[model samples]
Target: MLEDQANDPAIVDQVLEKSGLSRDDLTSATYSAQKEALFVRFACDVLADATFAARAGLQFKSSSSLTAYISKYSRDLKQVLENASRFHGLIDPALMFSLRVAGNFAAIEAEWKDASYARYHRRTEFLLFAGLARLRDLTQSNFFPIEIRFQHEVGSSRNKYQRLAGFPVLFGAERVEIVLALSSLDLPVPTYDPKLREHLLEYGDRVIAEKRQPKQKLRAQVEGLITRSLPGAIIQSEDAAANLGLSARTFARRLKEEGTSYREIVEDLRCDLAQTFITNGMPLSEIAFSLGYADQPAFSTAFKRWTGQAPSAFRSRLDVSAKA
Candidate 1:
């Protein structure tokens, strides 16, 4: 999309050559985030066009695959945004879009989980424009937001942004946000489908779960193994290494290179899983056993270390919040 909108369309070809990347790499079904970011960076450097990313993004009338289908079947704009926020990790784990209602206004805030990625002007520009385009497409309306906020400065291109957005565009704000009237969230999607929307949401949840499993990352692989083994005996480093077809020494070395250790991985995983189990109303003893701890007291000590509170205390807090 960026390529098509480049000032000199041939610049994209030059960028591909300069970056040692073939068009096939981008068009591949398995195009990864790193590859996409590389292409964007190369294009941005070569083109030096600030508005092209936003222009290209504004042209994105539809979303990708399941996300698009899910949006198409959602009952209203509110449901569409909710589903988008819920299933966002499946599309791009680095960026998160959240919808919040405050008084008479609704704000769709875009937060970058990977802080480094947030610094990329091209990527951030594309995110905002693409989101606005998708929302307009879903509602079949050109209704504008009350205002748009961006964290990056476009310098002399600021006026062009306002003209393009058909609304006020504030730069160097706290974050990327699209502010709209609260009632606009209920704007019905023209193709709303209750039944298909339900089914698509279910499938989106499964996809999110599948994405959480191990992929190519060593850390993710180790975490996946740890999670699966949590209900039984603790998985030792040597055992995990063998399972991954690596020697214990090599496993420890690789994990260290990834900025973590096997012991840290297990501790972190258990800390997270402990809170989840406690929230689900699991008995303290059962939660301890599920996390492979020998006894509840040991688990409680570790939990306090991890979260600065006992499991019972955390559960009580959750219960109080729920009641309130």
Candidate 2:
């Protein structure tokens, strides 16, 4: 996967814009930067397209990534695995990783729970494959995992999966996994640099310290909940709070501390979603229903308040502009 190197930064930036990320957010991110939510948003955009979905696994060079610095100090593959696992958590809480002793084969397992692209297993597999590519570069070895497994049906990226996994990809499993012989885990990494090992560990510590746990951010959690339910279900503050295992009062207080409220978030999201639905030519009535409005009139009033024009007028203006 690393060798194929499918890179299109423009496409990524376009998707990021649609996903409500600013230019500064993209420019500031590094391999070590905490990009948990950004990645989830990117996966959703990539997985929506069948042809470009496989390229979801393609990232910038593994050697330049923060994971590279973290694992470069390992004396052997085992230490590399340990250090990699430790630092991976700081990157994203949505992804779970574990190494299990399964007799002679050590299983490297990754799981995504209620991930943004939850139903799209291709997104999950591609992400894992991308991580594996980084591991391969870190180890600087010719070895491959004995088996690679995924829980989703094979898609267009089957051949790419085979090439990177060094084994046939298996599907219809309960979880995603990679099987490697225990001996492979004991091998020494060729790129080990003793001079920079200690310094890199110190650098890794600073990176981890600067990252905030996504779960702890109430505003982000609320936004995610609102996004996940959009064009599908009505998101009440109570329901959103319950989903986070917090009481409404507690959730409200937390959101207040973050300088926002549930009503404010819902309104912001509805306005953004309105533009997408309207631009796509969805009927105003349908757009209203999708945004969980009781009827078209209610939504229209809100739309006028949001954009200084009724939904119909706004859409008609868009049409004229397109034709002109």
lDDT by residue (tens digit), candidate 2, 201-258: 7887898888775444676567667755655576788999999999999999988988
Q: Which lDDT tens digits does candidate 1 get at residues 199-223?
A: 9888888888777533456877777
Off by over 4 Å in 2: 1-16, 21-25, 30-60, 63-66, 111-123, 152-166, 202-324
Query: Model 2 scores what on Cα lDDT?
Result: 0.65
What lDDT score belongs to each candidate, Candidate 1 first? 0.76, 0.65
Give the TM-score (vs. native) of candidate 1: 0.63
- How do all models score by TM-score? 0.63, 0.54
- Candidate 1 contains a number of clashing pairs equal to 0
Candidate 2 TM-score, true structure as reference: 0.54
Best-performing candidate as measured by TM-score = 1
lDDT of 1 at 164: 79
Q: Quick one: best lDDT, which candidate?
A: 1
